[model samples]
Target: MSARPEQREDRRKDPVDAIVDQWAAVRPDLDTRAMEVFGRIFRLSRSMGDRMEKAYAPFGISRGEFDVLATLRRSGEPYTLSPRQLSATLMLTTGGMTGRLDKLERAGLLRRSPDPHDRRGLQVTLTEKGLDLIDRAVGAGLAVQSAGLSALDDEQVGRLADLLRELLAGTPGADH
Candidate 1:
């Protein structure tokens, strides 16, 4: 059975609705169409994350592990990156990142070695098996992403991407 529709009259029922109400009262003359677009984008981001987590589950890896592996894979340098570097690139707390590294090490997907340039530093490198595993996991993840976008036609997808890029480029302090 289809899910029951929410009551349409309840204008302030959801968080977005409440925000709209507040903005309508506070700044009635300002343009709010951008806010609507961004609000849906924010919600879509959360939904996308959940779908990505589900996609990674079959690889027996958490989202954190997948991110680390992907970073090393993309680094194009023997799959090695210092823990501090990884933390900075991944925007994770150093302590939390250390724990992820430890977990990956325990899983035999990565290893730590003394950094040649620094006496007190270690570089985390992926093993051969780890590379193979991540390769498969990445393929699966791409399939999931493709499935998620199946509803959009080729032209729609391209247009959406271009529009999103334009909007993203204009955001203050946006990540390049």
Candidate 2:
């Protein structure tokens, strides 16, 4: 019912190969070489994100929620931050963060309090339950990501990371 290693490898035709072939046949003058890279990268990004979300499902959190908790957890002592700070750090809009915060607060995973520094502003902090859950979520997330990238050897992965960093460095809003 399952494929052996060779059978699996044989069936995997580097999906982009087919895409390139298809484009080449229809548009003889067009150069689709970049398709080989971006196509796979797009698919890989989506699939990896899906797998990571699955990993969070058992912990009863979406990737967004996990990110919020994890960010708060690592934000040093008091584990607190203003809504604006959180939205900025996560690249989310304050409006979007409000929905997430409301959900987390209802779950008792985080709490909001009056910001001492700014009257009429609120700060968010993780509850004890949130801290514990995020600790486990982070551990599980790392494991899921690690397993997903296991096809690459250490040197290959390191090189890939460096290459990705370079690519990210040039992209707008990618945090230079």
Each prediction's Cα lDDT score? 0.84, 0.86
Per-prediction TM-score, please?
A: 0.80, 0.88
Which tens-of-lDDT digit does each residue in 20-119 have in candidate 2?
7677678766666567668988999999899989999998999999989988999976899999989988999888999999999999999999999889
TM-score of model 2 vs. true structure: 0.88
Q: Which pairs clash in model 1? A: none
Candidate 1 deviant stretches above 4 angstroms: 1-30
Compared to the true structure, candidate 1 yields what TM-score?
A: 0.80
Candidate 1 C-alpha error for residue 163, in Å: 2.0
lDDT of 1 by residue, 82-175 (tens): 9998998999999999898988899899999999999999999999878998999999888888887898999999999999888778888775
Error of 2 at 138 (Å): 0.7
lDDT of 1 at 146: 89
